[model samples]
Target chain A: MRVLGIDPGLTRCGLGVVEGMVGRPLTLIDVNVVRTSAQLPVAQRLVTIEKGIDAWLDEHQPDAVAVERVFARSDVSTVMGTAQASGIALVCAARRGLPVALHTPSEVKAAVSGNGRADKAQVGAMVARILRLDAPPKPADAADALALAITHIWRGGAQARIDAALAAAGRRTS
Target chain B: MRVLGIDPGLTRCGLGVVEGMVGRPLTLIDVNVVRTSAQLPVAQRLVTIEKGIDAWLDEHQPDAVAVERVFARSDVSTVMGTAQASGIALVCAARRGLPVALHTPSEVKAAVSGNGRADKAQVGAMVARILRLDAPPKPADAADALALAITHIWRGGAQARIDAALAAAGRRTS
Candidate 1:
């Protein structure tokens, strides 16, 4: 399954696409950062983000999109922008009828590094190892985006198995 | 000038359109609330809001858009959604190249009711008095939306005057 992951932020939104299923090796399709100048009006910044996300969606056309869930408790000044950016990503995917999932930062960290409390360096190292890249993606946000995509693929596959098993059990009972 | 005011929320987004300039009787062109089911996914809910705001912009063709500025300190449980909704509203207006202004609740209250800390009922009553309406708009959100529009007109007029004066002073000094 192919997946696009978004590490949402107003200043630097990270986009990463990965193609892989649970057991197979993953391939990094692409990674990009959508940056907007703080000098621009917030409205225009949002428009820039929307357009960037739309272009990415058009090019990748992933089966599902994963966005990093935002929490208000994060950096007070930036949390709102993060939430706003995530909203744009969500609506952009939904407009095209693409399935979207939100995963928390810890969830992404745990999915790749086997530790929810892993530091950024650790998470980046794990992502590099998983994708067989010689070095971790730069700007940390890009690596986080890749980690989110990897998490969704692995978790989604496991959930699908559970769902199929439940359906089989229901059929037998009927 | 006609202004489209939006009170951004995921469940019930209030919209109001007011037309007039400073020191003139403001006319209420329209007021409505866009309600989205809580059961709906966040992405779909955002899309609903985007469509609602878009339709209002298209119909009113307002000279400017006034949106209530969202603060993270207000209602921790709902602030993220509020910010997201506001973001969608911002993008909708920016995409059309329509000037957008964000008015704080206190600013709206002060402009309409002469009190920065005015309660909802007081603000509603002041809005009704300013617009010459028999009654304030239905929901508190609706009234707040109207207040935002009124505030923008008044403040925008004052700002324009200040700019004109500054320009004249610059020319004299030059």
Candidate 2:
């Protein structure tokens, strides 16, 4: 299954695509950020983000999508922006009829670094090690996106099967 | 300034654009949803979303964008979809260099209905009453989007001043 992971943000939304089979190694297809200028108004910034994401989605179509859940309590504005960013990712995936999964930062960190409380550097190192990349993914955000994808790949098998079952049942009921 | 509020979703992303000056009543320019079917791949869904948003932005040219924050905890899949939807909305604003703001559901409810715990119907009624509309905005989601935009308009003036100050300081330092 191919999975697209996203770390959503208003200024810099990170995206990573990975492909894997149930019992095989995962391959990294792409990683990048959809960035916006802080100087711009919020509406214009959103336009840039929409276009960039559209281009990326067109270029690398994945079977499923995964995104980090934002749960910050400190800054309401930041949390709100993160939530909006997350919504955009969901809309993009759902429009395509691709199934989506959400993982918390801790869940991704645990799956990647074997510790939920692992720091960014640790998670980054582990992701690079697992992907056998010559260098760590740049801009912490990109690494986080990759880790999210990896986590989904590790746990997505059973979920996919369950979804398939549910879909079949729904079809029968309909 | 005009603020566009979006309630992002996979199947139906609600959009409401409201124009207002600092001390004047807000005007609702438009409200609608860009809907897509579940039969398509994720990539096609994203394309549909991009086209819808791009067209909206081009027509409205909003100064800022506001979106509803998702806080559901029930289904992981649903949350993931909502997050992605939010991401798309943010990207739409960011691409156009517009400043984006987000408001939690509770915050928007409070702003519109004078109670954070108000239900959708109550909030919708209040929005219609405040905007002096002959009918409540349809699709519940559309009303929520309008409420979010109003909240941003109410709060954005001071926030913009603060952002401007920060930008000036950063420019001097750089």
- DockQ for all candidate structures vs. native: 0.88, 0.27
Error of 2 at A38 (Å): 1.1
What is the DockQ (computed on Cα atoms) for candidate 1? 0.88
State the displacement of the C-alpha of residue B129, model 2, in Å, after optimal TM-score superposition. 8.3
Q: Which residue pairs collide in model 1, if any?
A: none
Best by DockQ: 1
Among all windows of ten consecutive residues in candidate 2 chain B, which has the lowest summed lDDT?
A: B72-81
Cα shift from native, residue B135, model 1 (Å): 0.8
Indicate the docking level reached by candidate 1.
high
Worst 10 residues of 2 chain A by lDDT: A72-81
Writing each residue's lDDT as its tens digit, candidate 1 over A63-136 gives 99999999888888888888888989999999899999999999999999999999989988998999999999
Model 2, A57: alpha-carbon shift in Å?
Answer: 1.7
Candidate 2, lDDT over the whole model? 0.79
